[model samples]
Target: MRVRELLNYFKPYGFETPDWMIVEEYGLRPDQIIRMDLNTSPYLPQKWLNSLGSRISKLRFNRYPDTTYRELVGEISRYTNVKPEKIIPTNGADEAIDVIVKALIDCGNEAIISSPTYDYFRVSVELQGGRVVSIPRKKNFADNVEGILSSINDKTRLIFLCSPNNPTGNTTSYDDVLNILDKASDVAVVVDEAYYEYCGETFIELTETYDNLIIVRTLSKAFGLAGARVGYIVASKGTIKMLNKTRPPNSLSLASIELAKIALRDYETVSRNVRKIVKERERVKELLSTLPRIYAYPSKANFILFELLEGDAKTLHKKLMEKGIVIRHIELNWVQRYLRVTISLPEHNDRFLKILEKILKEKT
Candidate 1:
């Protein structure tokens, strides 16, 4: 028998796994390809880039990183306005999801998820041999708060929600999350604010009032540090203490921790970039609306989700790929015919719109 029979494994989460070789695959130079699939910042702040040299010395790579991650926690505390003891530094938001699952989920138990928000939350719960009770969102990808509450039962151990959800580019109402928090007693509720900087609203303030609330965030989006892989969890001190045990020692590299600290030092730069991205996102939505048979949905994050009202999204995705432009083609039942594109630099955005117009014109 195969070893697969003795153990369980599933394929990893599927986002546009960036292939650098896409440059040669499409017969384009490195600079010609526009990576709009991942909602990462198109421009890395020069201030942060310049500080990487001096900051490199701060990490003691010769030795293992501090298990407690004291310095990183201190920096994060100042940045996020959360106390040091209440924070747990993670390798990425992905790690925080897994750690929370491991901490709360027992084998054969259940976790509640608002569907199509973030896939990894489902993956994390399933990997622990727990059942995922997926409550589908309504049209335009809005959450059904009552459905979520009714789904929670005695076996329910965790509930996960993502604000400014991935792939769909919409923020769940904060009041709905508060409603869940008030109702779901004895169950851990995780509100992932990974795109918090883009939207500028948070449930972090409620962490003090609710003991079971967990807020996870990452530096990958607006901070322009996706490559560094740094994220953190903000919860009450006791909850943080429990998660600390589940986390492996020195899980975050010294370089990553130091680089994150440097990146956080300049909020003004981050804010300026966020403003530009929001502006460009609106411009893209406006342009998409002007196109024949396309509907651009309102977005709070740095990406815009639009539907091809008449054509196949997969076909359009391939056409854009031919032009060396990459974006997310979401094929979920709720978002059928939908596509999501990151708000990129001005020239990249212009190029995408120009080619898209040509493709639709050809189809007509």
Candidate 2:
């Protein structure tokens, strides 16, 4: 028997799981591991646990979740000031990306993406037989808006912009984004604010003024509900209607929907934790800066992307792994010299930095 040949696009997509996956796959215990990878919120709110308990006992498990996810959409609408009809909830922001890409781009259409951003955008676009045109960032990891606009053409259907970008903790200027929208009226501009809580900046309001803009957000970072897998997109009603068609019926579980409702009601806990993480993030950056061979970037997100001034980043990562401290190494060609570290609780950040400092000294 012969298997059919897979599409050419699938060939470029490699299957190397991130460093955090290896840490978990190795069966390393938490007490022995100081994980600062994958940008996950280190603290799960106590209120989420209470909400989960109430939901497990009270929710009607036999019935499906509200197909439209009305309640969750309403809560997010009230928080974001967008109408419920303009929002689409999904399993995660990753799902929102796939749904939107599928709805907008056909085979052979182009999807423009800013490089050194999230990989999932390219992966999703490629899986649908869409071509990905990369606009490389500047030396400091800033978006090259001029280059991006120059690359767009009549065939370009979508553009993915990750603000306060992943792997490089800086945001694109709001004005630059607006300029792109002005130039490319035919292409959809997706502003992914997965780390919006940490930055407190957004283009959600722009959706009202521009028909081509869409903003995506997640509850995982600030709301501390990563495991629950809740995320949403805000766009004009027409764009949302098209995206809704691509989403699976009742994609969110009843338990996750109910838990998200409870979490939104108690917003104070999420706000407090986000503030704490931002504070701890600055502290971590300052401490790391003083070390002999470290350079920490200023971040608007809940993580820091830093570089080793005088050693191989992979070597440094290995040393940390041996000591039960895990951090993400930036392996992409554009950022191979850097490493991304998530902001955890105060003590956790302290321990990771302490171990990191010792590793730097040993290398010297």
Candidate 3:
């Protein structure tokens, strides 16, 4: 089968191919599975489910969604304290990334990204024919702000920053983000806050001060609406208007729009779940630290990243799966020693730790 050459760029993601097979071989039905690999919310609000059921039965399926999704935009506006005209919702935050890259990036132009961050930023930029200039983070998993500043040049068109960065579980400093914006005045800066609810630190306020700043958020993470695939970008009204030109009309489904509205309405439930996850995250860290060979990093997100001091992470991951416990194993050369596990329900968390302890004791 002939495929687009761009597919070659994704070869480094070794998990993409074998991940499904692992699930199948282990009889890991989604419902039966203890899924700590994806960092998904364990609880979906009852309100969203009830609303979706009623909307499906009452809404017109034959007709297309509102071309602009203006009402949904208004809800997001009120939620974020940004004007409706300044927000644009896409199929998901992933699509929002594609839209921004297409709108602002040109062939041979460059986008700056901090290394060992989310892999999608590099994928999207390369797919759009832009050069990816990586600035490696400090050993402590913080952005190398000085290195990023030095990398910007005339061809630099965009910069992607992932806060509480995926897998790493740490946040970028607000002052550092402001400094980058101050120096890279000519480039567009995208702050991806997919885990915003967990950290509660954001640069959405900076949109008022800098026209080049853009913030991307998704309902998939903290809101437990990943299946709805709703995500949005916040920017100045002018930038949003430009993004709309590239966005396909009626890109979101009627059901997704309705569910997002319902999710927003029940913000209290979401907040409660966030508190549970935060509390459980700290407990998970404490337990993992006491295990014989694990060194867990401090986190602001719903997941923890750790390293095995005496054994290979890949081996540990395989051993866990044999017992039906699943977590992410970081096998890339840069982060090869690390394994990331989501902060799941208390019982699930306890089960994982118990199994991990057994494995370490056997090795010793």
Candidate 4:
């Protein structure tokens, strides 16, 4: 016999994971490639490389991880300057989103999201039998404060906002976020700051004032631990105390917790790399500005979004792959001509720049 029917609003979504399968089909070796997609950090902090594995091994792997995650919570609290009671370490930021949506929104309730933002928020909200209200961003991919404020209603249980928003690579203003929070204090507002290390601006401080405010963060990007998948949520202790029940037992692995703690301890290493990536971002944007028919948007994240105003983004993306370099080509209707690339090391960044120049010159 078959299982029960699925929820109709549960739409299939595409995640930009590694492309090793495609690389092998094309008869290419892994070492001959540079991946400028997915926005993973190219640098690994030295202390993380040095000690986490051994520290993790000291504990018994046969035992389940600490569901409470006392040590990890302490580290995250120290790192974020939030209290330990306000935190819940998750498997990843994705899990944090899923749990929050499941906890707050009921079937037929609605969650508001600014469009062209992260897809998983929509996926999570819908999967939990909730409707997603889409408010389009401003022309520059900036958050639209008015649109979100007007969209909220009695059924609106959650609002997902991304800073240095994915794909678009720009942040929503703090004042705009404050405005939304000030008016919609009754609804849960999640400001996902996965790229906070690069931008250095966060809503963590505001969580103290607004119990409905939840902040989601990850060790994936700036910490170079995408593979580890460590993430967490911070809010007022009472709010966190309520949502913590929605999370599954042993949500994060032992290694992930230890490693996240290790990474937070070595703030210098990650901070240094973030500084480099920010510099590379500026450099890449300035260089792209000089090229004809291309527009580079200002960003505070680890990646840059550029537009091929005169050609197909997919074609250019495919051409870049032939050179063993990979960048993302976004397919959203609002940004059909845009492509995205992670800021890598200076050498890899140089190669991407030079090859891109060659491709554009040929088009010219």
- Can you give the lDDT of residue 87 in candidate 2? 94
lDDT (10s digit) by residue, model 4, range 57-82: 59778999877999999998888888
- Prediction 3 global C-alpha lDDT: 0.88
Candidate 3, 33-87: lDDT as tens digits = 5778888898887767876897788888799988878889888988899988889
Error at 174, model 2, angstroms: 1.3
- Model 1 per-residue lDDT tens digits across residues 267-293: 878899999999999899999899988
Ranking of candidates on TM-score, top first: 4, 1, 3, 2
- List candidate 4 segments past 4 Å from native: 1-9
Best by lDDT: 3
**Compared to the true structure, candidate 3 yields what TM-score?**
0.95
> What is the RMSD of candidate 1?
1.8
How well is each residue in 45-155 modelled by candidate 2, as lDDT tens digits?
Answer: 776787689669778879898798889998888888889999998998989998999899898999998888888898888888789999888888888999999999888
**Local distance difference test scores for all models:** 0.86, 0.85, 0.88, 0.87
Give the count of colliding residue pairs in each prediction.
Answer: 0, 0, 0, 0
TM-score of 2: 0.94
Deviation from native of the Cα of residue 144 in model 2, angstroms: 0.3
Candidate 1 global lDDT? 0.86
Candidate 1 backbone overlaps, count: 0
